[model samples]
Target chain A: MADALLETRALTAGYGEMQVLRDISLAVQPAEIVAIVGSNGAGKTTLLRAISRLIPCGGEVTFDGKSVSHATADEVFGSGLVQVPEGRQLFDRMSVEENLRMGAYRRGDRRAIDDDLDRMYTLFPRLSDRRRQLAGSMSGGEQQMCAMARALMARPRLMMVDEMSLGLAPVIVDQLLETMTAIRKEGVTVLLVEQDVHAALSVADRGYVMETGEIVREGSARELESDPEVQRAYLGEV
Target chain B: MELLAQVLVGGVLLGGLYALMALGLALVWGVLNIVNLSHGALIMLGAYATYYLFTGTGLDPFAALPITAIVLFVIGWLIQRGILNLVIRGPMFNTLLITFGIEVILTYLAQLLFSADFRAINPPYAGNNFRVLGITIPLMQVLAFAIAIGLTVAMWLFLLHTRVGRGIRAASQNLVAARLYGVNPRSIYALTFGIGSALAGVAGGLYGTVSQINPYIGGPLTAKSFAIAIIGGLENPLGVIVGGLVLGIVESLTALYAGSTYRDVASFGVLILVLILRPTGLLGRTT
Candidate 1:
């Protein structure tokens, strides 16, 4: 198995001519939860977008020992590198269950899909009862859970989540985080982008702090959490 | 009361054929996001194809359906890959314009070839009818309705169950996510357009059996198809049936009570009301 489930070497991507992600390099090892922390507009979402091939990018992105730099978003998805996009971009018109089914659009195995759906319901019991409800009608927290569960339905080897804690109550965020940790335990490598430094670092094994489209600092989560500079700058502490 | 019931039954039967006529246009619009102004023209062509097959080759129109579908599929595929794909990435208006252009070209060509003469496919069984509950139903109309509903169901199943169907749905929902599903956007797009065209062709073939068709019919049929798609909502295939039935009944009742000239006005008025009051459509969720 490749040491890094996903790696970006000198990755640069942007919308049109304005580069939002400069020459950047990062790696996510198998079975590790890596967190990227940055302020708003720090290119955290842009990085995920580039990695998932949603935007035109120039750089080497390799997944499972294969170069993904030239791969289309569908090709990247087919290779098992799935992303739960920001703002929970579920098909609002579809039922929650239908949205979940759409996540597994690439899979041909109906039996496995049923099994995974059952597992998703077990992980988010609230979703089970509301499966028939329109995804747009669900509460913000429930929508987030549905988004995460939908991504899981794809059976991805590496799952990228952008801003899981955004617009959620603290208790719901905690529950989501716990569910994410459980997902990682199932051997899926997770690369999380978050503005919540403390919450992210608590679950992450390693952390990278980004600023102005570049990684400004990297350390073990524990080290970064304790670093006075990081605490003062990113964690909102003196 | 009996007269009203009989009229309603007739309207429903006619509605079934209307649903079939609109099905292909609806599929193309809903899945491919192409309004396909040429849709009715393509249906006209399908009817012509069936007409020639029956008259020239002595083949049953039903038996020749596969051939018509395949030929139309190829034509649709070429149009998508050649003309449609060029503007597929551009504005929605571009598609509308190009398709309208195609419709004009096809209508002119059809007129030149078919001589602007109205044609209908009348088989040996054309006059047969079956009566139920004192309401008489034409066999052809019943068959057309059955086939229309059947095709709609099949389309729904294909989208839900088949790989290509899922790919088309994926492309419609999120192009980026669709790529992740390993579907080449260009080919999938062409394939979707082709399928839509094939459906249009099938609807056209069935239409020839029940009604007179000419190149001029394309305009009104196109308008009706658009109304059906809009009223039904583009999100689900079954929406077309509901939209078709509503339109069919309204048109029938208007023709009977308000004078035949008011039918078009009523259909257009209902369309306007739906647009102003519920743009997402009757079945679609309001955004």
Candidate 2:
């Protein structure tokens, strides 16, 4: 728990009078792929938003031993807690290369930024071929890849990806999961919020099952996969 | 035929200045989503600032542009950060009311301080004219046109090349996403309004050299700026040039053919036509 890169204590958040997240507590260790899987409107996105400080939340969010609950979104991002938001929110009018450059907006080291750019192209080869293309013009799979690459350019210590598999083909989702594993192998912690319970747990080291704004179950990926309640509610397997 | 050629040339020159006038309004409207009804007031302030610098300090009006731009930039930054940002998230109507209020306050302030006397910046070379291809061109108008075009192009490049410029564009498209990439929306919004006001300042300085300036000129100038911005489209910065040119030429042609009294009729008529035909402006792509 002390070594956890990201930990939330009784986090609660909502929009206006409508509360979405209720006392949700979760932790992600360094270099680990942790998934928070749930159905639609289960507060997975709101939890991610709360952690990233995009929305106001109660309780505490600690990142890398520092309390960041009240930190502004810019501070959270600058502290290397980055998020690849849902819906592949790419700057539609800007070119693919520009989007990646924006990801490195906070970095001052020019040489390192360029090196990271090259690394991103190598990681997502399709992006290299379409560097000049507008981000919005790309296919959904390609856009998602670009979004992931854009976040990586920031050289974050921990990256939170929300709904990465949304509106994508199954094969594309598998490829993305492989990319997430590879990203974790490079010593970056990942908090993946996904609706696909089976796919998320397969690659995640540990998983939490969220239902209706609260975490109902939490365990190792293998344990969650074997749990009959989780299978019955999410995996469609009884 | 010679008269028509002369009028067209004059219109083109006027169009260049018009482009510069609308550039600031377009930038602010496009990025900040604040239509900035006070934009012309800022322009009026710029013109008065230049007028005073020329008369009081003996500085050339052209040389006074940067100073005016900086002054207006500060004022704009303060206005946005101090007033507009508070109600920015409330409703679009609040911004409209606040900006309009600013415009009225500025107009009254100018009237009390500078008086309603019409002033012009007349350098010794003001009356100098050059003849080319059987058409006479006033040196001051040409210089204003050249500076206008230069500033407009520079603004376009700044938006394309600089980090802050990219931040403005990114913030305009999506504030939440831009914040995720380490952009502070409040500061960026303030900086963008400042830049837009600076452009307006430069345009106002150029306007002083070419025409007469008065405190009441702000309203008409703001209306003209809106016309140009709409004709050019809000999406592209360079669209202001085309929009400016269209309005200038239309006005000149109307003055020459339908008499000077119908100039507004022609310009606004074209605006109505553009609105009916292409709601996105000339360069804006249909969504």
Candidate 3:
């Protein structure tokens, strides 16, 4: 088996006194696309947040062989684990290009950044056309594209995307899934949290089923797709 | 017509100084999201540093600028690291209160050390003036104005071209992503505040050559800096310069036509109107 790029061992976290994640353990292999599917408030987003060190967490979160559980959010990011948060979170007043440039803020590789930017522009040609436009003015789908591209600009070893399909139209969602598959093919590992079970499983190499903040089941995407329990509970069919 | 031209030139020159005065406040507000009430006190400290240097060692105020900036930078760094950092991650109101407390402490300390005597730095060429286009302008005012604009431009260039400047800007935009860049926010916060205070100090030193300094001057200077920052917007560095010039011209026209006492009233009234009508100053895009 390929080495895990990221590993979470019995991880637990929550806001204030409310425990949201209860001993959730997971791992992502290098260059693999892993998807976590769950109902709303099942601690999927919270899990990503904890792994990124945005919130205080417990147990072990190791990225690239470094302990990230006690690390600050910024430290976690410095270790090449980047998160495209639930909301687009683009700086609304900034131009689209400026927002993308901000993603490479920690990096000094100007040549590489420029190359990545050109690649992003090619991936989302609409963004290239509206490069100078304010991010807030863009349509929802356009903003999502910008957010994903911005995260890519970081040249992350592991990218965590939360609710990539949220509030997006079906067509846009399909396009985004295609982009995610393409990104995975580029040798970048991805950890995707999604409500769109069918769409997620279609592109995901492996799938984890989460319920009430715990990983209830894990298997190959094909296995989970045909599982009776997954069909009844998440696929909305018997 | 000559009087109008003279006032216009004077207003423009004064506006440059005003821009320098507001630059630090705008930087602190823009980057650190801290409205430093003690900003004027740092400016006051800069003036005192210049005054003492000139009186003791006879160094020219302009030449002594770097010294004042360094001293003020140290002071700002210590304040941020020791006092301000504790409450920085808390509510905005906490920051305001802590900075206000700092203002009071600095003011009382200045009063004890410097006294309330109004002081000015008079170099050998202090009384010199030159006529340009039939309008008389002081040599010191021209020099101060040039230095002010020069420093402001340099600051803009630094932020745009340098890695550290980008880090500061990134931190202002998103703290988490800024950290991903390997920027220790605690140090960045201190460095930004230090740079802001250093700018204030330079402004204060230049101001001493052009105006009077007392412990009481800090309050009004703070108010003027705040007005300039709001009028300029927090997003762009160049906006402060435009905001300063606008206020300077307005104050000059109001003082000439209305009265001297109406200067603050006019400047602050315009600030209020701008906030009400368009809160994001000229260069700032509404968020």
Residue A113 in model 1: shift from native, Å? 2.3
Sorted by lDDT, highest first, which candidate order results?
Answer: 2, 3, 1
What is the lDDT, from 0 to 100, of the residue B130 in candidate 3?
Answer: 93
Candidate 3 per-residue C-alpha lDDT over B1-287 given as tens digits, one digit per residue, 9 for 90 to 100? 99988888889999999999999999999888889998888999999998898898989889999999999999999999999999888899999999988889899999999998999999989999998888899999999999999999999888766768867877887676556435678988999999999999999999999998987777788889999999889878888899889999999999999988899999999889988987777666443
Question: Candidate 2 on A69-147: residue-level lDDT in tens?
Answer: 8899999999999999999899888889889988988888889988999999999999999999989899999999999
| Residue B136, model 3: Cα distance from true site in angstroms | 0.3
| Candidate 3: CAPRI quality band | acceptable
Better of 2 and 3 by TM-score: 2
Candidate 3's fnat? 0.35
Q: All models, DockQ values?
A: 0.36, 0.60, 0.37
What is the per-residue lDDT of model 1 for residues A106-149, given as tens digits with 9 covering 90 to 100? 78799999999999999999999999898888999999999888
- What ranges in model 3 sit over 4 Å off? B176-184, B280-287
Model 2: CA > 4 A from native: B285-287
Clashing pairs in 3: A106-B181
Candidate 3 lDDT at A20 equals 96
Query: lDDT of candidate 1?
Result: 0.86
Provide the TM-score for each candidate, comma-separated. Answer: 0.92, 0.98, 0.94
* Alpha carbon lDDT of each predicted model: 0.86, 0.92, 0.88
Model 1 TM-score, 2 decimals: 0.92
Error of 2 at B240 (Å): 0.3
Model 1, docking class: acceptable
